[model samples]
Target: MLIPLIALAGVLPAPALARGMDEPRASLMVGALLAFAAVLAALALLVQARRLRRRDMQLHARNAHLAAANAELREVTERAEAKARMLDGVLAAMADGILVVDAGLRLAGWNPRFPDYAGVPRRALRIGMPLREVIRLQAEAGEFGMVDPEAETERRMAMFHNGTAPQRLQRERPDGSRLELRRTPLPGGGYVTLYTPILAPAAAAAGDAMQAAFRQEWTSRIPRLTAAAADGDVAEARAVAHALRGVAANAGWTRAAAAMEGIEETAAAGALTQLRLLTAGLPQDPAAWN
Candidate 1:
């Protein structure tokens, strides 16, 4: 409306000059100039308003995207926490001690049995602590005997760092309990150590007694048993071989048990040649029984 009024004023000024109205023409000219300035200012304000609206829309979009990303991050965190809790519960219920270290050789996780098997206090084995430190503490507690704790710790740490293969060994704790230790490496450059108590004093003593009785039985019986097999006495050979099988199996002599089973089978089948062949070298391989 103001633009059209200014155009009408421009046309009217020429007519006013033709009508010789000089004073009125001058006032009309000033009014037309003000209207034109107002129109320019109005256009500027409209352009600014459109730009503000567009910026507000962009801000809303960005905010929505941020909120979605935050929600996803929170969900992932919750899932990880749930899995961790499940793992913790499973480890706690296990009978053996489990200790896991990270790529940095720092303690990552453990079960309650760790402290018991390691002979170290629970407070001494903190998560994220260096495994060397834990070993030092156990050594100080006399788990490793009278050796220098620092040197022993360094030796153990070197095994992992130097790309050692998985190893299993049995060592005695100062508390009279024997533990079987197994160290396994992770594909991602870390290690896990498991400690399983192998025997109590009573169990070890009983085992020793059983082994002594088995050794005596083998010593007294094998010569006669072999002689009977060599003589083609199938009944006597089978009976003696069966008896030795039971004793060997009970005493954890896997190789000897297998040999005894072969002997029993040959005797039962009356294969005199195979029986004699098996008995021919029995005395020479006595270490197999031991």
Candidate 2:
């Protein structure tokens, strides 16, 4: 390219030479300057091409990184969906009806069998509704005898919140089917209730096992309750007595229930010796519970 520029400059000088030597000198100088400008433009284009290639490579790398991130997010989503389905299956497969509520008593979870077991109208069931509202509807339907609906709802709510209260309740439907509800309060400020029909044969076998286990538990707890009461630890004694009383009442151990109540009261009154005496009176023999 430089050779061609020099040859053209030489021709321009030749045209000038035909006129005079002095004109050829000026024409040659102008031709050389034009060639230098063309070289500079070519260098600028090469620099621009290099910059474009570098930018293209960076974009490709960024696109690959985004694609990898998207794949990971999709995998996590799929795993979460699978776990949710498994939990739903477990709830659905249960034979008994289940109802779970949050700390605020708002309905948190329930199974299909809840409606059938509770005998509550399906229209009253709302996933996030306050459970007291449903109770009010049942009260209006005369589920709690002839009492005012609001009063009964309040009464039941109070019972549920009572730490010492027994949650075992028996209900006879209009069709003469007997069912039992057992509510277990969770440590995390919620409760789960199980509803099952009072079948004779199943109850007979299950009751024996449950009775034995509860008797053992109560006997073991008597010592802890005694220790708490003897130390005049009102909070500890009350908590132990409350738990023991609920279990005893459910097991139909009237004497044990009364004894636990006495421990709670005496500890609160600062009668440490009387509380110890009450704990000592609890019978340890499982047969004595009857």
Candidate 3:
């Protein structure tokens, strides 16, 4: 509207000039100038729109990347937490005393057996607790038996070098239970300690008596069977070999039982030659049997 009005106003002054017809040429120049300006404005708007569109696309791409990264981070965190929970559950369920220590010698974890053995509450355990303090507590509780301080220090040094050592100790419980303690190192770091109750005196004696009687019976039988085989008493040797085979198998001596079975088979087949060869290698002293 402004351009046309200006053109009209300019023409008003140029009516006398319009009679000569130079005004039409002047108006045509003005119109061309307006069209050029409009074209330039359209190009400017198009360029600006393209720039905005590109910026939006870039923002969307960046946002998508951020979302993917956040999702991956969340998944990693969840997996780590789940693993920690599982490890905690397993540690709590174990009957052995497990202690995890860092390279700095600070305690990282302790299992229930720690309190059970030390006669202390779990709350007393702390992250920065010293190894010496733990040993002292057990000693005061009478949990460590006959451990020489110098020997203990040497053993600890050995453990640091070798990564593990099994140490035996005795514990007298408040409940009157006698416990045998064994301490071993964990694979990667730290240590594990186990406490097993010693059998009662009467039960120990009974087991020893049973074992002695079995040993005596085997001592008398094995030699007689070997002698009978040497004397070519094939029938008596076969019977004795069968009995020994059963005894060996029952006692979890599978290899010895198999050898006895072979002897029995050869004897029963009347192959007295193989039976005599087998008897020749039999131990005369039961003490050297194993």
What TM-score, computed on C-alpha atoms, does each candidate reach? 0.53, 0.53, 0.51
Model 3, range 125-203, lDDT digits (tens) per residue? 8988866666555555555455765556456556655656447778587667677767665577566556655779898
Per-candidate clashes come to 0, 0, 0
Query: Which of 1 and 2 is ahead in lDDT?
Result: 1
Candidates' C-alpha lDDT? 0.79, 0.75, 0.68
Candidate 1: which pairs clash?
none
Error of 2 at 226 (Å): 48
**Model 3 residue-pair collision total:** 0
The candidate that achieves the highest lDDT relative to the unseen native structure: 1
Comparing 2 and 3 on lDDT, the stronger one? 2
lDDT of 2: 0.75
Clashing pairs in 2: none
Q: State the number of backbone clashes in model 1.
A: 0
